[model samples]
Target: MLATIKNISVTYDGVGKSFSSGDFISGRITLELGKDCKIDYLSIKAKGKSEVRWTERHNNTTVIYHSKDKMFSIEQFIIREQKGQDCNVVAPGTHVYPFTIQIPQQAMPSSFKGAWGKILYTLEAKLSRSMRISSKARAEFPFVSKADLGSIPELMIPQHGTKVKKMKFFTSGKVGMDIHIERMGYYLGEDLNVVVSIENSSSREINKYTLYQKDSFFARGKRRVSTKDILKELGEPIPPSGKLKVTKVLKIHQHIVPSIFTCSNIKCEYRLKIVLDVPYARDPEIKLPLVILPATQTSGLQPPPYLTLGLTRRERKPTRMEQHTTISTAPGAYPPTAPGAYPPTAPGAYPPTAPGAYPPTAPGAFAPPPAYGMYPSLSDFGGKSEWEKR
Candidate 1:
């Protein structure tokens, strides 16, 4: 139990949403040998292993996956012969480092709950002639959205025209495809303001229109978010068209997906399809798709699910509350001791009176003092006034 161990660690250069399975890790492990060295060979190695299991309810059958574990073990170096080296040389100190391990896309589970697995990577030092110490670094992995990880607006404005259907106009849009303005927000707590302009290029007075917004990521076949789903999140009625701007003000109450998962050289993308539902109807409920893809995922990352919170619009309560109060303490009774408060005064000192009326003489305001001085002045009978009375 009291053996010297090598230092080992695993880290990524990218942050939260950008963590990838293909990122590489590089580090070293050192071992120190004492006085007299080893009698056999020695080296360092890395091993990976994992197991997954699940039971389907449809048939009550358990599906077992035992070989899901992948390892990356390598013999750091073998020392077979050397001049009769000191213990430090024979059992000598050496380093056993590690390299990067790429995560397979198929292995990445969707972002849904109950679809997850754990992975472990370890490194150890082995010596044939003697017992040596070992060390390992472990990390937890979650399967993020596995689809619709790419694309943009170039698909919006079709060169010729937008597809018109049952109250819907669809297109990736010509210029709206790749607007790289950081100010366009989409994550939790972010307010997204977007404008997709369609100029009846057809010289027709489009009477009705409907729009549906989709999560860009959904394009790749992952999960997709529906405008209806977003509306549900809003809990209110939303405008359909003409000039409609969806301002999503964030209400941070719980786990609002704080980050995204990605690879080292990956850039995620979102897509939008403005469905001018009814050909001529001016305003109609429409749909747009938001997509997320890696810069390299041109083939595209799968998108999330189509979702909406079903939010509706309604008139706000008529007006502010009508406030009225009855004071328990007399008006201005206690004069403010601090700023904004009146100074303390006896109850009813200041009675309600018409504008120019004189003070009603606060009740008991003129209480006459007890009569005393008129009876006899102290100076008048100071010396011997008592003698005469005796």
Candidate 2:
């Protein structure tokens, strides 16, 4: 009888099977055997890698350039034979094996699909039989390692540049172009404002102008660049010594990845390229550097709080009367004593001595005062009070 891999099912921790770097992927593999079959071993393997390949035709032969990097690999054996014994022969039934693997966190590139390059993650189950033939089952998935923008503050700042080029080789006439942008950095779903001015002193007529946003990667000692056309405008034929100005807003797409800078072996960058097409003449091109950030970092595009109804906000200031009223209406504004009443002494305490009376002397106790001598005594007033004379 023949042994075969029946099916493979991969399950992740979250709601979907999709995962990111540093995530744990767990799944099960099922095998079916028609009859008793001897097997060398059963193994499951997981791998993540990136590959780039393209072919160029030389004089009569084709030259191919290929580069590949393995990000991670993990393998687990489900069944193995002893040193002196043959492979295990399983009964004709279904067998299930479970596996879990943790993806590496360091230097993990985001998944990509391109015309000549790809980053892929795969899981495979192998059933090694006694014969040369082996039954295998495989599955593929995507992983994303998000590029963070919070650490690089400069990327959020605005950037601008200008370039001037001659209309054709060995030509006296030149075309001066200036490109200005509202910011150097942007997140997905945001709009980028671009201002361009072209001063054409050349004799050739400007036919059209195209703006391209390109993502470039330098990996494995080779450079690969991909571009998406963001904006295009038909140039109004500029006569000799004429000028043209344009202002446009381009929307960033969510499918694009942020600029990558952490990896030494793999470098990713973006540029805004402007091409001015001249009829019957070499096109003049300019490149402006750009930084792409994560969509979550764009606060302006996020939803506002539920309590706010998306209205224009104004700072509210308290009036003088309102300020005074708040303080006056407070619960503990006044002291504990009643109005127009003397301040009370401590609880269960005695009052101070009278104006002309004294207290009995005792250790650490109050002392009695002598007769008045600073001013006229009460006897000098002829037994009448000073107030009566006044």
State the local distance difference test value for candidate 2: 0.52
Q: Write the per-residue lDDT of candidate 1 for residues 250-279, one digit (tens) a residue.
A: 232123221222211111222222333333
Best by TM-score: 2
Candidate 1 Cα misplacement greater than 4 A, ranges: 1-24, 30-52, 57-114, 118-232, 235-289, 294-390
Per-model TM-score on C-alpha atoms: 0.30, 0.56
Model 2 C-alpha lDDT per residue in residues 131-220, reported as the tens digit of each score: 567678887866655445455455555556677876556555888878788755677778877787889887756544454554444443
Candidate with best lDDT: 2
Superposition-based RMSD of candidate 1 using all C-alpha atoms, in angstroms: 38.1
TM for candidate 1 is: 0.30
Our tally of clashes for model 1 stands at 110
Rate residue 353 of model 2 by lDDT.
38
